[model samples]
Target: MERNIYMNTITVSEFSEDQNLIFNRVKKTGIPVIIMDKGTRLAEIHPPSLPEKQSRKFGCMKDRLKIVGDIISPASDEKDWEVLKY
Candidate 1:
């Protein structure tokens, strides 16, 4: 009665017949169409993906981040911390 084919699939013949419409949908929706044949996945059709963002460089926030107090000194008195009662 029922088949096990994917819900988001398009047969090779259908893809061939309506390639223009399918490609237009792929371009507009950005969702890939899985080409199938007898429940076997054949190929995918969709627009090329774009990079999310450029890789960040080291020290790119060198001057952006603010620094305070002495660099080598402790932040607070050692006696103030109960965990350091060694």
Candidate 2:
């Protein structure tokens, strides 16, 4: 299981006192800031995830790959097999 990660935990009162600094840090680091209240988790402040790259989709490299004829055929004859030689 993945563990919860944060720059650090802060109480609600402390967070309220330094919210701007905390927010700026979270945005710059791209990590979460866990806010707690009375020893329990209340909320989290985090930066938004980056947009997905379009180049990762299937067939994105189709134009870059070149296949010659008879791709399904074997490159060598069956008589050349090591097991057959024995």
* Residue 60 lDDT (model 1): 73
| CA RMSD per model (angstroms) | 8.1, 9.3
Scored by lDDT, model 1 comes in at 0.74
Score each candidate by Cα lDDT.
0.74, 0.77
Candidate 1: lDDT of 4?
17
Cα error, residue 9 of model 2, in Å, equals: 0.3
The digit string of per-residue lDDT tens for model 2 on 14-65 reads 7877777888878988778898899999998879888987666887787898
Give residue 24's lDDT in candidate 2 (0 to 100). 81
TM-score of 2: 0.51
lDDT for model 2 comes to: 0.77
Top lDDT hit: 2
Each candidate's clash count? 0, 0
Error of 1 at 63 (Å): 19
Please provide, for model 1 over 1-86, each residue's C-alpha lDDT reduced to its tens digit, 9 standing for 90 to 100. Answer: 01312235878878777778778777878778898888899998877788799767987788797777697876789897788997
